[model samples]
Target chain A: MIEAAKTIPVVRGAFREYYFKQARAVEEPGKIEQREFGYAQFGQAGMTRHLSFNSIKELHAMLVKEVPSDVYCSNAYYKFPTQPMQEKQWLGADLIFDIDGKDLDLPCVPSHTYPVCTNCGHALPPSDEKKEYSCPSCNGKKAERVSIPCSKCIEGSKKEVRRLIEFLTTDLGMQRDNIYVYFSGNNGFHIHIGDSEYVPLDPQARSDIVGYLSGTGLLAESVGVRKGREGNMSFIKFPRGGIAYGWRGRIADKLKIDGSSIIKLKHIVDQKGGYAGFKSELDKMTREMGVRIDPQVTTDVHRIFRMPGTLNSKSGLAKTRCADLESFNPFNDACLLGGNKVNVRVKTHVKLKLKGEAFNISKESAELPAFAAVYLICKGLAEAM
Target chain B: MPVQLMTSNLSSIRMGTGDLAKYPFLNEAGEYLRESGFGWEELDRPDMKDIIDRAAERIEVGVGGNIYDKLEKYEIEILTFIVSLIMVKSIGMEPVLKKYALSEARRAEEFLTQDLKQQSEMQKHSLFAKIFEDLFKLKIEVAEDGRLFKVRVADYLARSSHFHEQEWKLINRLVQGGHVYLDADETVRLVRNELSVLIYEKVKAMTLPTLPQAIKVKAEELRAKLAPRYEYRTSAVTEYPPCVKHAIEVMSKGENLPHSARVMLATYMLAVGKPVDEIVMMFQNAPDFNEKITRYQVEHLAGMKGSRTKYSVPSCEKLRNENLCFATEECNGIINPVQFGRKRK
Candidate 1:
């Protein structure tokens, strides 16, 4: 009976280890205990009495001649093919050059201010007011004047800036603090990444990070890891072996034919590289021979992420920032890339304390916090720190 | 002889010559009779009788023949015709007749008189002809009332008993008074109240007997038959002990029994020292036992603690065996300490 057992090509060792751990945890009184080596040892114990025959031919003969009560069992694994690679850069790059006026000196005063209205058109007094500057002429009944460039000057530049920001932060996984946004002096904005640590990742790693940002990576692997069943969930390990083993166990249970009988039939093969490659071969064999192997196999390999605080881990960072690239425009002098048009007509008042002296910075300051603020904002990093 | 013939012709001519010439007195008699109400009883009055008699006498004198005999023999008919003609004329038949009347006064007069008599006879015949007509109308009204009554009764009875047309008709007849008889609305109210009472009584009387009445009765007889040698246990040992016989009866009767009854029986049997294997075997032999036992096991294991569900029974059993009782683990975990204290005591 042991000699009659069939050999199936699958990553049986890896899956057995995983399933054994799960089965042990659930073993308790008044519950069905998981069988240990039950699939391999069932034939030797003569428990096969419940089963009518050792082979498909014998089973078929029993079914024809006898009461048709014999149960046949067999197991197979599940596997599917991995997608073929197509060469394309997962990372994107965008370069913006200043074409307006002569470049300013290093550490130049970042003062570029325009006074219009924080709300609607009504010239405000030079006094440094609160964050919300209301129109004094209308007594807050009408809108205050906003300081934005005329619409004709900056139309499409802000969108380009926004796209660049999304590609860097959400796609490239670069921290917003690592990004530097600056005005091009004439039209558009330049997004500079001085950090070099993020540049040399492999395509797979880049794709994985992209997948994490888009929230569409390996869900099964993460769940398996959280479940704490070894080999069930792993970022680096192949899952096809375990999936195939589970399929084999299910098929054996369903068919009621022992694995030995399958081995005697000489239909099983020990395919290398786990059960991942066995799925298509098994399907072809089943289709041509009009007989299906009990267990199916899955071959697809996927990359999983170990992001902090996700998948049973504690202390996951919960928040990130996004740059408002819709405000970036390039056609107008006040416009930056990604449709960010400087509000030339709107005035933002800031009080800068420099050298123990408070400078009431109004719309007259040439250096506003637009570049610094935008860089920090786009990378989903903290601002003003 | 020729002279006599000429005189007769002249007399006839004088009698029928003009409106005033032929029976001129008829206009006056007609005017007198027209003032009287035309009811049949009015014809018997002395004044009408006298005018009619005088009219006959004048006709007799004018015609120089037995005109009075003719009038007397057919006076009722003639008078009725004349009254009817006058009534018809008053109601606007005279203008129509006048327009069609012949220019010959004697012939026109004779024709009008004969036509009036015929019209009067036709009216009498018509009254007798349609005597059964009103009977059909009355029957139709009664039938319509019966239909409405039936609908009301049917609606009322349907609320409690199965709706049957014959039963509704019977009830309708049994009840008296139009409001009660055809009182479909009131009947519905009564039916609902009666059904409510019936249902309440049935539910209130429901109980879980340890031994079913049928089995107890049979057991007594069997014990009596064996009384000389052995005695049988007639009472149940467990509170709300399950009665398998009674359960079968309930199920057969098509009534949904409370699930507690089955659980009570199973638990009681188990408490009384029935082995699990024996219980399983017993269930296997029982009708529809597989379904019942499977449901019982699943529910007993899965149901909330203290719930009347089958799952609750197992939890209770577990506690009973351990002699450690607790409402639930979530109740501050007090049961563990209580059990420990009990053990210490």
Candidate 2:
């Protein structure tokens, strides 16, 4: 909980200032009146949702007046936006995919995260090596981990975003312009597909799409390596042309062989214990190739998604869209705070680079830029002086 | 006889008379009836006796879980199918309507499989595309080998939602360039349930005139056989444990439940001696419930399929570990949910 008496006002004032000046940066979603809106205020426990807005101006007015810690809009459209869920009469929803850096298997994770025992409050020194740590002092099994994402973590997430976009375009045949990418204002990226064809899909259909993207249940026979009817004979059957299409094409490309070289493909499978061994190889290939995504976010039609231009309460950064992802940097571009300096008392040793400046502060009272002060304050690492 | 369909692209095509006879539920078949000036009054004429007899036989065989005979004359085949639909509507029993639809769909599927196998490449291509689009609004394309069919990812997802097997999952299938590849048998099977649903909807919406005397007698006889049997074995809803009640509530809203919750509910229902069909009916409202798969799974849990090992309800401690326990203060403590109301009963 934020100490409501002390840091809440300071953080709220900063967020209020940003909204007053930059509310125009918020993009207006299509069919505004049909979408539900939600806002969470500072020091509040739950969100106030089932609200509707007719235009961006009305939404901006609320942002400036309420100074909410977070703002959200529904991905689904409804005939009556403010009605109860059962009566919402849902028409359709834009398909959404979320990729968070915290969920990835990054080797640099231990460098940014440290574990503390929940039972006895024992803290462990952070290290670069990857392993599960038990509490040394209390010998308790329960531990709470604290993570502060760095630039490398953000890059790791961006790599996943790139791979996902490639699959959306080349494999799914979604148009380039229809796929929108945004910095989630924290540690991840949010992809919104604007294609109307995808909007009306139900939860079951979206689960299948999720299965396809995540490569959950891929079968060995799909790529044409099957066991023969007679004794122990397994062979490779490719499409007629030496060049196959779809997953067959992908397998051919991975093996660097066309369909004409069935002999070579069979030889490769035989090297790994025939068809059964080749199945594992195919599984490994799909695991390596498939993109990581949060399945629940895509499948839930009733979700209230974070608005694009709203400030994320976790990092005090703006969730902004990337027109050109290659050149976009979240630290400089999405940092919405002005140059006014603020005084804060640091709670712990912290080091980070933001908006072309570096800070390495440790157990000291210091005057810092407003953006940096809000960042640390939001993270509970500092209190207003 | 090959049923030829003509189309250059995704547009609807002209289906032949033979096609109409094989798939009498098609919208074009309805159009063919209107064009031939057939009306409800024609059913009262003396010459319509053969059509009425065939319609009655259709329902009898449908309820017996067998496909009806195909008449030699194409016109009679089409007309008899129309009369069978009317007889089913006159009975107005939901279960019987579903059974009749399923049997008809099965018959059409058999003919469809033969047609897909025997037709030339060009003719088969258009027929496949036309039938899927007309019935389910699905888009299909021919694969490179000319032996398999491909459907758009969106179309395949909507059509295959009810399949529970790991092999039927979209990820497990051969997907390339946004289309899933399926052989002729697999492709036809994808639409079988949907075809049944289509026929069911049509029959349920009809306002049929009074059935002729012969047809009314057959409808009465079928109703006596097919109306839901008394549900005496099933316990009242109020006596169920809180966790079981929660599962039923979730399913009633067509909501998704955790896998453990589903297992707990299915096992508890089976342990209480609920019929497999009744257990299946309880899950009918779930968004992804497919009858064939649901029946197979329920029977499997009942120890009727594969290994014959009946599953017991999880204990309270197990449910608590799985976060499924919904205990309340009822002045009694029990180890398992099944034991909660047992002694009182």
Candidate 3:
């Protein structure tokens, strides 16, 4: 049973050193110990909840102790009367934003999705996940299987993050002093807005902010864009008011329709007219422009998030902060361990790019550097020898 | 709406400051700005960062009213709401803000009804902004007698379409004499979604002032004082279920706990073997309490004197639906207070 454990790649000495570094925890543990924390170790049972830390030392001690597969901490700071959380008072919580590439509706990247055999469970290479999305092992017995992401897919996610940051600063009055952005170590990014001004906002208040971003329940007619009251209004002329500076104005300008001409221009707005259906057109437009957000993560004050500076098990990448968001590259930046090599027994064919180098491996044993091999091993493409 | 003329000796109208007097936040620092060629004329200049820094430093020490004193009532409202947000969130000013907000909500109701001539969109938003500004930031209590009372202000505010549907219910209470006190976390709770949220934050940030420690402390102390005061008999309270404890606490504060809260309280007391007279006696703090009517109601619920069909204590579902459930961890899987106490055993 011990010998039958899954195979993974690691450089000659890097995997052990990475394990040691994590065990020792070179940096101060529980950097966000002031915030509430919960964890889930690799268990045969399932993910656990309500695991908290008293201080950074305790959290670091847990890291060395449990070596959890996933670690999470709440965005909130609470004064717990007891560990039971019954008598605890909600002091405040940080505003958080999460944009995921896996959740994005973008077309298939070159190496993002993977096709797996429904019968034999064999997954094809990411390159052939689309178009020829048939299992090579089972000989065309399965459909395409969606995987996490490729580097280019994450780049698309990064662009969304930049756009969101800009919207938050200009429209929501978020100060740069309080905003902290981190890669989720998988296929997305997590942004924490620790602005003092926002801590007091409630779930409903946060919901309103999220609504604006997602355009879930946006009220374009209620905005000052229309000249008169609803049912009796005139179109807003170009170079709109301060209120229409965001998408409400942009969408209107793009469609070249004003309130007065809205019904007359129904052909452009809603070609598939089904009596009183222009509103559907508006919904489509908002959906196109709106940024998809994980609402539960942001509004929940007690929500625990992935601990930064730890390993993201899915990708074998460190969840580190981006010093410069624009120049940040997670594939390279997430590699925290030093240059060390480990021999890996190849169990399956896999192609991966890491630290500015690309490698293609066949179904044969091979030795590679630490970062690249670790990526394959973590991805379960090889076994460490 | 009138173009009121500025005739004060310190009237810096011609200083090209663009309606600074109307705002009412002008002071020595403002005068210094005027003297140093740094009014609205120098507002958006890239070189004014140093001047802004000096101004910020002076304000940090708390001596200048230049920026705060001359703000128009409306401008002050937006600024106050922003500052009040900090106080409630960081400093625990829920009670203080609730008190401030209750009075302000009353004032806002009155303010909203007043037919001011030529109310522009800006003026309307300003009116709302000022109400909220005062609601969250200020700590004003002119008298103990007038500090709190009962009113159906939630119902009143709900009648008007101007306010958020959730607000009046959360904040206002039915005070006696057909008045209500707007005192709840709703002001602090509702600000993030309020109309001012739509305002350009960069523009709104200019009006915000750093809240001093004194204000926060005062709010915290008042909030501590206002913690749900319950005059329950100590011996009786120990055996009361979480729902009963919660209902009595709200009632003791002269609040009209929901109709279901009252029903649940009565039923629980009846089940606990408390006499109808004592149960009716418990309701005296409610502003709507009337002896004969309360006794009749309690007796009807007891099933001893009225309809003869004894009403069972509401299940957790009913209590939760009435928004009166305050279940502790031990209360889990227990439906009635009698069961809750037995489970503890």
DockQ of each: 0.00, 0.27, 0.02
Model 1's alpha-carbon lDDT is 0.28
Number of backbone collisions per candidate: 77, 2, 33
Error of 2 at A195 (Å): 1.1
Ten residues in sequence with the least summed lDDT for candidate 3 chain A: A1-10
lDDT, candidate 3, equals 0.53
Best by lDDT: 2
Per-residue lDDT tens digits for candidate 3, residues A184-268, read 8777998877666567666545654565566543333432223335442344332212223455444657676554554544444
Fraction of native A-B contacts kept, per candidate = 0.00, 0.51, 0.00
**Of the pair 2 and 3, which is ahead by TM-score?**
2
lDDT of candidate 1 at residue A301, scale 0 to 100: 15
Evaluated on the second chain alone, the candidates' TM-scores are 0.17, 0.64, 0.31
lDDT tens digits, residue span B1-345, model 2: 333343344344556687788888876677677777987777778888888888888887986789986645768988899888888998787767888899998888888877776647687567667778766777777777777788877778777756655467676566666677787777888898988988998998888776667667767876776665423344443488888989999999999888778889999999877899999898898877899998998998999998588888976544643457776755145667777665443
Tens-digit lDDT string for candidate 1 (A1-385) = 1111221101122123222332232111111111011112212333222121223343233323331111212111112111111221123211111111112111212232223332333344333333554455554543322122223332333344444455445423456676655443223344444444433333222222222222221222211112224432212222222222222222334334343443321222232222322333433332322111110010011211111111000100111112444453322222111222222212245433221233354543233233222221221111122
Q: Which 10 consecutive positions of candidate 3 chain B have the poorest summed lDDT?
A: B58-67
Give the true-structure RMSD of model 3.
Answer: 20.3
Best DockQ among the predictions, by candidate number: 2
The better-scoring model by lDDT among 1 and 2 is 2
Cα lDDT for residue B239, candidate 1: 24
**Which candidate leads in TM-score?**
2
Candidate 2 chain B, poorest ten consecutive residues by summed lDDT: B1-10
